[model samples]
Target: MSRFKRGAHVDSRAGFRQEKEDCPVPYGLLKAARKSGQLKSIRAVLMYLGSVPHSVWRLNIDTPQEAQQNLSFGAADLTKLLLSSNKLQSLSEDVKLLPSLVVLDIHDNQLSSLPDSIRDLEQLQKLILSHNKLTQLPSGLWRLTNLRCLHLQQNLIEQIPQDSGQLVHLDDLDLSNNHLMDIPESLANLKNLVALNLSCNKLKSLPPAISEMKNLRMLDCSRNQIESIPPVLAQMESLEQLYLRHNKLRFLPELHCCKTLKELHCGNNQIEVLEADHLKHLSALSFLALRDNKVKNLPEEITLLQGLEHLDLTNNDISSLPCGLGTLPKLKSLALEGNPLRTIRRDLLTKGTGELLKYLRSRIQEEPKTAMTLPSQAKINVHAIKTLKTLDYSEMNKTHQDKSMTTNRGCCRKATKMEEILLGESFLSFDLCKYRMLAFIKIKRGLFRFP
Candidate 1:
């Protein structure tokens, strides 16, 4: 007889024994095997029934039936045990008796602790403890070195033991939405770790030793109280996606060596300045965000980011932009909303980024150059009259008074063609006391001289 036992999947009206009109062998099968009979135990009972036709084990057992089992799955035939949502306060110690167990899911239970005998199941590879009231893990949990996936999220846990680093084979660790104040330094010992999430915590800084994780590719430390990112993070050559949003960072640390960084999200911070040298080094950076900060200007050196594809500068105080930013060849999505700049036409807001960039490019290209002409009075008259308009009498008077007082103002005015006027449509604006009389006399052949 096989030592494995499987439970029955039957409704409330399940028949235990067939009444009068049945074959004797079928009647024997309908009867529950007596403890002292051929099936002495549940395992032998399942083995004897294995020869029966059309028998399926119970998989979707409700709370009533599960409670009847009392969270006990001592049957060796049980390779997968799911006791989730059974309203059990704790797991039975008999769980360790199942030596062949491979997957165990007791999530969504009210258990605040685990049986110390859990370590006996050396074959257990996956454990789910999410939605539990566990504040700390079992001390023997690290002994399960075969664990490849562990889900401990949404718990009241406040700290992780330094011994957690013993899980060297762990490739993914999620500790989000907890009350953790800091991460253990032993975490750096997990050199094979590929993804880590530390969001929604109070971590002020990360251990500098984290740079040793050469295989780490995704890191999320957002929604923390971190004030500064250590410059050593820049040396993480394999890092690809870094999320540092919702922190108190005031400036971007020099990331000259993060050559593989592709997506950087640093929004919702106090960053106010971006150094041109720092930007020139991010050759591989594609998606950049500086939203909801106090950034005021974009350096022309940003044009050197040849691979830049998406730039988000929404909700900042940037009043103007460097003209060359529009000519970036690879730029695809550019967000400039909620800024104070009116550099682009006011009506262009509804048109979108492409239209705005094109408008700025057109504006720069069509910018009129102040025409330079001959040094003769004729050209001087046209140039001065066109450039200077509605002269400030008070300013001129103060200048003249200062000249008379300083005694060299007249000498200064004689050296420069102090002022001039020219003919134009429906306007005869002139600075009479200075260039006014000079231009008039020159055109009149010195007819009305001011000597």
Candidate 2:
């Protein structure tokens, strides 16, 4: 303790503050090297760590020991390593030191190559190396059998090794935005893959062998030069979503066998017609996107899509729609714009999906007078409802009051959400909104009917 009074200034005292050298915290690699206690190896490791950027040098150490004791980052304990957005030019072979690593993300870097030693990471489950400049992947990369998810998008890779099928456990593989004009036949061996993205590539066609991946759920081949799809693709039992936009396809393959398919996007193609056989088996389909195509009309069987939600037919050549489509229980968004639709007026088309469905339903409620307009060769054999003297709309609603009353607030919200997806369209007209309010009010008044 100083003998000076408490008010004395430090500047007045000689050598007021003692200086100390700044020592940075010991990161993982350095600490582990120090723990080994081999002077020569320690010197070599320290020099390597000193040269490495701060990102990977930390080794993502999660636990610590006493400050005086060197910490050994156990390979088993370092299960995850994230070195993204670090501008890393190269990781070299040192990454193999972390054999127990389960997740390694090095995206958005300048890596021109990867070390073949990466195959040593047998326990790695997810490896993200997207947004790099690598034109090729090391042969050893395919041998990582335990890998589950591998993302190599936005790379210059023109080819993939045939051995890529060795990754049996992989479920998600995104190789989009690459220069791959063709993929290897062995890619079909990834049977466990659930989601495969090959979008924005130079692929002129997809291999029919890919249909062998029975477990694939979502397959995106959009923005390619593909002019056709393999008929066998419809045989995939687990396929749910298929995207083939921005292609040169003139027609769709019959997917009658793919019952599990939910969404099929084939926008910006040259499909001039949609066959009923192609739409019939897609019973589970919800969103059917056929925008910017040459489709002249929709098949009457389109009404078979009972679960259908959003139907995007923008910029097509369609002139009419099936009245039965309005009868679909889940039918909601109906996008119809930029088409040469002569059957529907401009003002009515601009009114949006809800009003269009309502109009179609009203047309359905009318008596069918088409028999008088059709030619004798196209004779239709049908009994008119008026000729049968069936009950009218009000009569049916009165009998089915229970069903009408069951239309709860949840159903109304579903309608609102469905209308929200009608891209770039005007909202419901005032009369339409008023009619909905009246229907709900009718429920409260104990006279509920279907809206």
Candidate 3:
């Protein structure tokens, strides 16, 4: 005969029955309980559903029926399931009952391994198992053919099973912060893989079979000990973005045929040379980062990359430049900080790319005689014999010289004017005439010198 502790009703707008904010309860359930004479049953059910578990169920009072009734439904069709930071040592066997799960985020758990029952979730797409103590993946996980994204980052995984290639449909795989020494050849079977992040691992070299993944667009192998890039990887047609930062690479990958490449980041490596053919083939490339490498020179052929937009050569040993580099049509952002380039102007060190280009153009134009040499040569008679060293100023005179006039007469007139200028006391120095005569004799010998 215990009376049920019925709390005050809650207002929808104000959230309390008295509008003064007291502990709120539902009015509909309380009204139904009073009419059915089950007020105590309703209160116990509400309390059990709303309260968190304090301890193991008191068997004397809490029956199996009460515990089973506490389970909440309607969370089954949820796409994202987060069970992180929980005291869960193992996933519940009942999680397999959720049929509509897509993303299973259970990071920061004490799970040493995953239950094989999870493989039954055919609709599950992304599986995040980070920060767990899993030393290996379950063999049954290879059966999830529909999985497109798998994140096993920050785990205790030391080796990838050879059967990892079974994930043919996976497009993204993140195994960063692991203890792997080599990538399994089975990974090449993931033909649809667009992004593969193996950063912060202990890998020493990449497998040649990696070129088999034709759809790979982004690859991050940063912070590893990779010493060489396999030449076979150059044939990967769809590879667009590559990250090999902080590695021990001494030379760039021979990715000459990878035309779709857009960004290549190999910063903090030991690369020494960049090939001219490498730059010429990357027609679609926009960003190139070779910062903190051992590169010494840039080939003039680098200007062939008309689509290049951002170039970062910071902290390298570069000391000069190919003069034609400034003529690149699409080059916008150029970071040359910390390099010892001798050709770059001191005043233009802090200038923008446009101003730098303008300065370069002005310099090219300042030498007008040198710049006009090609066009002047185009107008000159190549077949002319007895070539005149002096430019003809008498041609503009109104009276045309008769062809029959003797050439000796013209030579005597020119030599008489030159002799007067040379013998004058007003001359800067008398020895200058001897030097001029020797220079003219040398020029005459060179003009008639036969091979």
Candidate 4:
């Protein structure tokens, strides 16, 4: 017989016995046997060791009976514990028994508060309590300096303790979907933070100290009642993605230092002007959204964005566009719908972005060069005057003294008719002798004086 078959009838309280149906093996002896390598068969070893201390533990004890039966294990060796999607109204103080615990996830529960004994877990690194009914965080949470990720989103958190910045090593934080109206200034102490989400809140403004997060890459403060953003936002050199949609801002902040920014979403606001100073520094921008604003004109400097791919300007008051907009090479998605554009035909817009861009380029080519045009009523013609060699007033029937004062009366008669057709009959009564003397003196000298 196999060793597993021999140990099948072992009792729980007794040591390994011979031919006994009621007596079972002791737990301590089975453990010792497994430790000394006496248990050779894998089946026998599994049958002997049913539940033991592991580095990771997960339990779904929603009922009272299941909680009492399943949660009674020794957690001295546990490093991670997940009890999500349960009816856990509260956590027991016994959680402090797990000294080596590093991660605890109890999201999607009815947890309203955490026990103060949670501070005893000195090695805890991540605490995920999102989608809970937590109204306030315990004061002991700040003691977890080693914590790197803390998610308290979708909760009823009304305020964050000022000392919350004690978690200096935290990298990712999500406090969205809360009722917070303000934040603590000490939050700037989290120098290692990378991503911060404070969206879907009632915040009116952000602390000025928030600009101190030098390593931050992404920031989402959308869907709030914020009236203005701090100018210090331009100082975040490492910021790549910024979201400020659905706010009450009246203008865009000058982003002269945000050179690494890639995506900026500031749609659904009350912005009226987009100046050159607001766009000159965003050299690395790719996506810009300014939909549903009151902007009337886009500055000619907008073509400076060489890498821009998507530009959304729907429902604006813009009536014209700069011709340079057609020269951008990388623009692929341009949304000008719901605008009051009068120059571009509606049919052309319906044809899509390609046709619209082609039309703008054609307009650039069709524009005429700078030149002064004369009216049709003016019969004066100056094209025949090859260098102003003669000054002839035909109505007066006389010609000025030219290169050697040749008195060619017949040629002078033809010049009189041409002058009448050019200068009109208004010069008939003008004094020709005085003007002729002035012209001869001017031609003789290098300087010509205009009367």
Best-to-worst lDDT order: 2, 4, 3, 1
Per-candidate local distance difference test: 0.64, 0.71, 0.67, 0.70
Work out candidate 3's RMSD over C-alphas: 17.2
Clashing pairs in 4: 10-24, 11-23, 11-24, 11-25, 12-24
Candidate 1 error regions (>4 Å): 1-88, 98-109, 121-125, 363-451
Write down the TM-score of every candidate: 0.62, 0.71, 0.65, 0.66
lDDT of 3 by residue, 1-451 (tens): 5598777996567733342123333445333332332222223332333321211112112233324688532211334555455545666555565545677777776677887778777888888888878888778787888899999999888999888898888999999999999998888999999999999999999999999999999999999999998999998999999999999998878787798999999999998998865676677888899999989999756766678898889999999766556777788988888999887776786978877767666764453221111111012221221222332212211233222222332322322212111111111112223223222211212223257
Tens digit of per-residue lDDT, candidate 1, span 301-408? 677677888999999998887665767767888888899986766678668768767766676456522322221111012222333322222212221232221223
Best candidate according to TM-score: 2
Kindly provide the TM-score of model 1 when superposed on the true structure, using C-alpha atoms. 0.62
CA shift of 214, model 3, Å: 0.9
Residue 254 of model 3: what lDDT?
Answer: 76
Tens-digit lDDT track of model 4 for 257-304: 888999999999899999877886787899999999899999866777
Question: How much does candidate 2 score in TM-score?
Answer: 0.71
Q: What lDDT is reached at residue 319 by model 3?
A: 91
Residue-level lDDT of model 2, residues 1-451, one tens digit each, is 9997688555755565433222233455544533442111223322333323332334434334543367434332456666666556788687776676788887887889999999989989999999999999999899899999999999999999889989989999999999999989899999999999999999999889999999999999999999989898888999999999999999987786788999999999999998877886788999999999999988766776878999999999888887867777787788888887776778988787788888788887684432122111121222221222111122122322322212231112223311111101111111224123222211122333357
